[model samples]
Target: MTSQPPGAHLPDHPEFLWRNPEPKKAYDVVIIGGGGHGLATAHYLAKNHGITNVAVLEKGWLAGGNMARNTTIIRSNYLWDESAGIYEHSLKLWEGLEEDLGYPILFSQRGVLNLAHTLQDVRDSVRRVEANKLNGIDAQWVGPDEVKKLCPVVNTSSDIRYPVLGATYQPRAGIAKHDYVAWGFARRADEAGIDIIQNCAVTGFIRKDNKVVGVRTTRGDIAAGQVALCAAGHTSTLTDMLGFRTPLQSHPLQALVSELLEPVHPTVVMSNHVHVYVSQAHKGELVMGAGIDSYNGYGQRGAFHIIERQMAAAVELFPAFARAHLLRTWAGIVDVCPDASPIVGRTPYDNVYLDCGWGTGGFKATPGLGWCFADTIANDEPHPYIAPFSLDRFVTGALVDEHGAAAVAH
Candidate 1:
């Protein structure tokens, strides 16, 4: 037998610079997922709240879940005040995230354009833009000519079935290297002495008198004072095991990238009417995606017809992409809510918290979600940022629906 170092080529495994250590029998808090959100939560719980006794338990590799599976679009030009507030807080943290974490997340500030293809889309987008501006969110409506200027490669001509009438542009909105986000947070969280337990699948919760005290995992029984369920798409499973129910349903969301190419698209272009959103990555690949599969399943693969429809729309919107070779495709399971928003607050269990139902918007929300969630866990109360997303909203009917999310559902 031979020893291998981190990043050793296969037949060997690649490990993080700060790999997961042995699971402790107990911790102050245990976050059930090691995605960006979980890592960020641990980091904030240590860095911000000074609650360093934390454990992030993952069934797989860190950030290998939906955190790294998204298109990496970051924006907070939501229509409602609640949606805009939390996202804007996340966006602000994103502006300083790299510096705060001491890691290069490759956060870009290019721009994001949400196209309006029909009369209703235009009307709704205009209203959404107005609401965003009223809430002090940076958002503006660009006419077809300006939309073409922002993204010259786009087909704004009226000949197409869904011609671009106008668009809502958020100049601060852009994409980042999604993988580095999780790794960066993990590195910092590990430095804070928070345990990162990998390949440790949580089997069940340890509850006494209806209060969760710890969890049973494949590794061992690790008791904790508090637990945060950042399990994302698998939230229902954990909630089920803990004897509770939520409206969250898991669905497979797919995305694909084209072979590397010369920089053609300057900004992110999204068209809900066409059902395709595309952006040029820092590597010059045409990164694109569409809505989720119509059916719900735990499968990480979506129906081919849905992808075919997305490709058709892509070619229709960007004729230049017609020749771009499709390199690869993949999917991530997302936990969707009926309101197309997220749930981030206390669960029924007194000692358990939740950060799930993020569905399409988890990646962009990593920083803000973690910050507020860590506060909620440490203080035993929801912060103003996550107050609207409380589990009680389902009963109070205080849902904060954003019309901007009506398109591509993110």
Candidate 2:
């Protein structure tokens, strides 16, 4: 058989980007989970705080879980002020992330449109646009005609089941190569003398009275001055080991992609009413996804009915998508909070930080949270941007609810 030329269909995969190091006996910090958030935090810890004595432990391969499974849509058109502040900060960081990391992340800021279907969606979209504008974020409400102009493939006619009413447009919003983003952060962190240890799962915590002194891992016990939890879906397991509850429910969130086609989809389009989000990836596949599964579980796969609903919504929004063959479908276990907002602050135990409950917004908030998380870890104080999302907010009844604007949570 003739040799194939590097599988032109697949996205360029980086090989041996970072060294696989053995866990040191002790470090100034030990970050659990080597996903995008963990890697970003590690990069910022060394770059911003000058803290290079750190180790990022991963249960599996780097970015092999939710980081690899997400649909890769990045936007900051959130409704609330707290949500807008953090997400918009993330969006700004995304703008210069490639240069800062000294790697090509393939970030495309083509734009994103959050479609409004009914009168309620239209009202909410307009309100969110105004809210975004008030928060210094670039957002505007566009009618169906304008939506059709932005993405020609969209069916804006009123005859559809969920007719296109209008949409909230954020010109700075877009998607990036998820794998490239993770690799970029990992490489930079690894180069800074931070250990990136894969397959090193944290079996338990080594704690003194009200303080986490170290961690017990699969490889061996490693002492730490501070321990940060970035485990995403498995955060509850870690917290359970520490004898505390975070009020997070883990669920399977699924997404899929279609066979590569000519770039017909111009930009990312999300509809919360119908519960389907679509965007054509850099590789030309139509990426699609919807909400999490109804039940709580750690499984990285969802029920067939969820995928069926997602496809139906996709077909209804873009008639042309019905003919495209499905390339593949996958899921990630996302730990969601009661208020649909993330919890990022000091845990009940001293020297232990909490960074979970991002739900579907984890990928978008990677760099921004990393920047702030590094500060939080370095100074032992919550950054102002993430202060409102403290674990104590639940007890204080000061929730930053983002269910309506979170899109996928619908």
Positional deviation of residue 135's Cα in model 1 after best superposition, in angstroms: 1.2
Q: List, residue by residue over 255-338, the lDDT tens digit for candidate 1.
A: 999999998899998888889999988888999999988798888899999889999999999998899999999999999888
Candidate whose lDDT is highest: 2
The parts of candidate 2 lying over 4 Å away from their true place are: 1-15
- lDDT, candidate 1, at 241: 98
Residue 99 CA error for candidate 1 (Å)? 0.8
Residue pairs with colliding backbones in model 2 are: none
| Residue 25 displacement (Å), model 1 | 0.7
